[model samples]
Every structure is written in structure tokens, then in C-alpha cells.
Target: MFDGVHLGHQSIISKLNAISKGKDLESAILTFWPHPRKVFSPSDDLKLLNTIEEKKYLLEKNDLQHLFLKEFDEDFRNLTGEEFVKQVLVNKLKVQHLIIGYDHTFGKNKSGDFSLLKKLGPECGFEVEQVEAVNYKDLNISSTQIRNALSSGEIISANEMLGYNYSITGKVVHGKKIGRTIGYPTANIEVDAIKLLPKKGAYIVDVFVNNTPYKGMLSIGTNPTVEGKLITTEVYILDFNDDIYGEEISVNFRDFLHEEIKFESLEKLIDQLDLDKKRTDEYLF
Candidate 1:
């Protein structure tokens, strides 16, 4: 899974688990890191739905027997379909059965599809199975669809496809402390550079501090009202007051509240914040 372990990926994993049980075999996943895209297009601003840490957590939660993470680079990418299966899947992994997503492809030029795999399975002494696409409201659930929904601020649809809230983990960092001046102290979050941020807007989120959850409102954007120059992710936790700087926290995006707005003055900004808090309270209750 490149990004979020959305429902579509879960479907494939679930099948792997089920088939493993039926055959009394171990289930394992062979995933590539430093995504192939990053290797091919080094300069592109490639953001991901889940960090490597998050992906590990999600996969482990699925109870897979083993995880084989391999680095993806020019050398690895150059391997042909036959070589990949013979050397990696057969000799290295000793995989007796391989369950792949319906659209899954691999090896150089993506020449390894179901047909290619099936043709080689007999020679390789393995079985191949493909899990059909999982659908949500007639739309096929996929990472691309989830990413599109998130980038467009459609959190509800995205979460529906994910089977969980879209979340980001970051560390609390220092800010200008302007929110404190406005009676709404905020926590400025510094997330991974490669993490995909949702649309620049206001959102209702659940803040997890040391694994405990709290309600919060998050704003992601450049502070246009304050003439700020850099993009920031900030959150105001309701009824919370603590020194959490340097602490790692996770924010689960629950709902899209509104777009970031530029106010005429600090007073106007405070007023909108009050309204946002009110809406957040109503929604949470």
C-alpha cells in the first residue's frame, strides 16, 4: 500500500489471511519502500496518505505473519517480471501462495499481472489468487479516490472509503503564540515533510496525546489573515491547557468544517474562531 491502508488494500490482506488459514500457511506482505515514484521523479512533491510508521502500525494490526519491506531503487526497478518472481518471491520469500489485488502489477514496466503470474505459478510451484475490488457506494475504493477526496476536503467520503478517519501524526512545535493573545491558545504541529496534507481549511479533528483522545478544531493553511508566509497546521483543543511541546501527537480528521478565511482584523478572526468552536461542540455532542 502506497498511502492509506484503505478498504481496498484491507480486502487483499483479508484474503491473504483467510487463504493462509485454509492452507495452514503463513501470510506475508512484500512491499517496497522509497516508493518507485520517488525514484523515477525525484523532484516531484509526492505526499503520502500514511507515513511508513503508520503503514507498519496498520499492517501489524491486521495480524499478518510477516512483513518484507524492500527498498525500491533503480536497481530493484530494473528487475524483470520473471527474475522478480524467481529470485525474490520463490527463492527468498519461499511463498507458496500469493494473493494480490485485482489490479496489482509489478516488476519492470509492470509486466507482472495476473496472467503473467498464473503462467509462472506452475513453473515456480506456487498458487496465485486475485481479490476483487472492494466497492463503496458503487465506486471502487482505491488510494487514488481517497487522495482525491482528501485533497478536495471531502473528509466524509474519504473516511468512508478508509473504514477509519484520515489521520496525521506530528510533533507539537512553537508558533507565534498569537492564538494565546486571542484567548485561543493553539498547538502548532510539525508533520513529516512527505505526508500528504488535506486541503487547506478548517476541520473537526480528534487529537490524541499520549494515546488519550480530545476534541479539537484544526486549521491547515498559511495564515493569510496575519500576513503569514509559511503554511502551518495548527489545532485548538477544547478545554485543554498543557505544555505539550516536543510531544508527538496524532490528529484524526473527522469532518470538514470550512475553508480557511482571511479576516479583516484580529477581532474578526476571534469571532470566527468562537463560531468554529461552537460548531465543533455541536458536532461532537
Candidate 2:
């Protein structure tokens, strides 16, 4: 729905769980898939921090039992604010209590908000609870801020706002084998499909391979020294070796160490990689 399921959305969901107490009420999340923006009009700028599959997996960590994956279409978008509530919440889910953020909105033209919900709650037989805005050291927490921080490579503050580490998921693809030729075997990951990638640099990463976690270092850029031109995510697993071909890996980026730089020679690049490997060892150990 939003760019990422950052700390602000986590706060709202936490509030919903708190109000439920010990009643054992079934909690559900209704979010659009393929993104509303993508459906309405596609843009290269509309990069998603979490794919819908990843979002569903993350939501499983919360108290929510299920997610209603709604396809955003012009028809669904045409509904007025009140009709949306009538169909989705009242008639369909029979929702007894609805929890949302203070500024959250739905329906056509975003005619729904905390104020509108309050005006209509009495007739709908539901109680609307709007959680107060989340704040971080006197600053408001928002998805937009997190995205901006990521685009600027301010991952520390961005991860703080996400309440978790910065992460990405992708499928392993075949690369030019230039890293293997240079003695540092790497697993190349394709990242441009629908995920938001981090800054081009070296990162201490934890890679989930076949459901097992492994410490790794990732390089996020085109290799100028190796004569590679396309941007690729190349990961070197620490003290681990396996044929991970065609395996999908979920990588959690721990820290941004440096920007990707072009070395004058391949030998210099290899020398720099030695230091990179050692720094990665220190990070994960």
C-alpha cells in the first residue's frame, strides 16, 4: 500500500493489537497489491520497498491472521468514501472496530479521514479508533521520510524509522563470472523488477538462502574495474560455499560502509576486496 511497512505503519498496527487486549479478536490487514500507483499509472520512480509477497510474510510476524489482497482498479477507485466503508468494512468483514492512523484515508478523492469516520461510525455500528501520529525525537515518522533517507543513503536513520534493518529480496541471476575470475565468487542478484534497492556501495548483509541465514557482504553497483556495465547485486557469503544457483535470497542490509568506486586496475580492485572481506567479517562476527 505504502512504499514500505516502515515504523509508522508498525505503530498503527501495534495500537490495533493493544485495543484488542485478550478478546482473541481476529485481526486483518486490507492492502492493495501491485500498488495503486502502478495500476493507475506506472512510473519508474514508484519503487516498492517490500513486494506484496514480502509484505504478507512480514505481516505474519504481527498479530494479523490474514491480509485481504485487493486489486486496485478504476472501478474500486470510483467508490465514494462512505460506499467503501459500507462495502468493505461493514457489509463484508462486519468489522466491529476499525483502527487507522490520524491522517489515513481511503475511497475516491480520499474523502475519508478520521473526521469523516467519526461522523459515520454511529450509523455503521463500528467504533473508529485513530492512533496518534508516531514521533521520533520530536520529528514525525513517515514513509516518505524513510524513502527520502534511503534515496540519500541515510540508512541508520531510515532503519530506525523502520524499526528494523533495511532489507531487499530478489532472485539470483547469472552474471559475467568476472568476480569468479578474480577469485571472489559472487552470487549476482537481480534488483530492478519491483523492489527498492539501496545505495550503490558495500554493505554488511545477512542473506537468507533456502531458509537458512548466512552472513554475507554485498556490492551494489556496476563493476567498472571488471568491465561490467549493468548494475548488479553481488554477494560474497562469509565462510560459506554452496551452489546457490537460481535460489531466491532475502538480504537484510545492516550498514552502508562505502560507495562503489572504480579502481584503475583489477589488481587494485582485488586488493580493496581483501579489506572489504575483512571489514565484513568484523561486521557479522
Candidate 3:
């Protein structure tokens, strides 16, 4: 999976484009859908960084010409390294110059590695190269690291690795008008269940409404102060006072302000909201 298409992934794609252009071969990316873990370990509840559409949108902005999303099922998983190289890479894609990451593996049980590809390249009439890992502040940038950063509410670190802001796109849905009573009107957002959400916290964000950007603060957690049970994603856009129910918007996470806290009373909650707003304005504006 190109997952976040973080810096490391971008390095590989950059190398792929350079080599393909030098060799005069078409550039492309081959990824699998339903994530292999989803097929083999359904109980893991694996959240993905990008939905398929999001992946396509991200990849389309890159220099590559084609993106092949192969369905990964039991049958596809059972293919041996040689068989996969022969059937998929050689026959189907007609791959001539293949570029992969330094740690990439494929085929049954992940038996395929750089060595395997090197061996098969000559026999299969193709060339192979592996891009070195990309690093930031001496930290190896990878999808796993980005996920961990987001899971820990380290939005700044995650964005550094991603080379862009991590964003959530969803539809505005009606929420209990609790925030309005507290003088902070909010819009409830409903996103795809499988999209990986960062840790439950308050974040400084840039909310996009009708393609226009506005400063905002977002909360991703249950309304514990209000005795709510289900987790909710709500954003209070600063200076934006409009009914946006059913509107599609995107929120680009900037920095994590604080973690969710349960207040003793509504007065306490409102006080915290005031502080949050103050901090958000200071940081954003």
C-alpha cells in the first residue's frame, strides 16, 4: 500500500519516474486493495491512511502515469514469488524497469525481496532498482512511523514525515446542539469508518468550506463532559457562522493542542473551551 505516500514513498516514486524517463519506459505504481491484512487478519481492525479514492487523488498529483490497483485475495496471495513475477509483473504489466523500496517484499509469505527481483530481472528481461529510505531529522520516515505519530496525537511530527498536512474529509451531519449552548457552535463530521483517525484530542486545523480555508479547532472523542457515549468528530470554525449540514468539507490537522478531558461541570467545560479557543487563535492567527 502507498498508504500515506509519505516522504519515503515519495522517494521511491521519484526514483521510479527518473529511471522510467531515462529508460523511456512508462511509469506506473502497482498496489493491492482490501489491504493484505484485511484479507488475512480481519480481526485486526486495521485502519487505513487513505481510502481508495483518496489514494487515487494523491497519486494523480504525482508524476507517474498509471496506477494499478490489484485485488488481493486468497488466490492472489497464494502465488509464489516466481509465479507472481512471471504472471503479474512480466505478462500483465509488461514491466521493463521496476523500482521498489529498500524494504519492499511481495509474493507468498513475502518471499520476494531485492535479491529475488535481481535474480528474476535477468531471466525475465527487466531491470530493478531499490530506493534508499527517506529520513527527516535522522528519523526514518515510513507509513508505520507516521501512523504511530498520528496515534500519539503528534500531528506536527506526522506532517513532517508526510511532507504535507494530514487531512480528514467528511460530510457535515447534524449533531446534538450541545456546543451551541456553550457558545461554541460546531459542525459534526461523518467520515468513512475505515479511515484511520488520529488519537482522540483537540487539534488546530484548517477547515475547508466551499473550497475556502478557515481557521478552526477540532475535537475527536466522545463528549465525556456531556455524558455522551459515541465518539464524534466536530469542528468549530472561527468566524464562520453558517449552516453547513450535508456539506462536504475537509479538515487539515495542524498541531495537536490538547487531549480530551472531562470537565466537572458545564462551567468548567466552557472555561476549557475558552482556553482552547484562545490557544487556537494564538497558534493559527
Report the number of clashing residue pairs per model. 0, 0, 0
lDDT, residue 58, candidate 3: 86
lDDT of candidate 3 over 66-132, digit per residue (tens)? 9999999999999988899999999999999888887889889888889999999999999998888
lDDT of 1 by residue, 107-209 (tens): 8998788999999999989999888989988988888899899999999999999999999999999998899998999999999998889999999999999
Clashing pairs in 1: none
RMSD values for the candidates in order, in angstroms, are 1.0, 1.9, 1.1
- Candidate models: Cα lDDT each: 0.90, 0.80, 0.91
Using TM-score as the measure, name the better of candidate 2 and candidate 3.
3
Let me know the TM-score candidate 2 reaches against the reference structure.
0.92
Candidate 3: residue 77 lDDT (0-100):
96
| Model 3 stretches with alpha carbons more than 4 Å out | none
Ordered from best to worst lDDT, the candidate numbers read 3, 1, 2
Residue-level lDDT of model 2, residues 169-285, one tens digit each, is 678888888888888899998764777777788888888898888888898888877667888888988787788888788788777778889999989989988988888788743
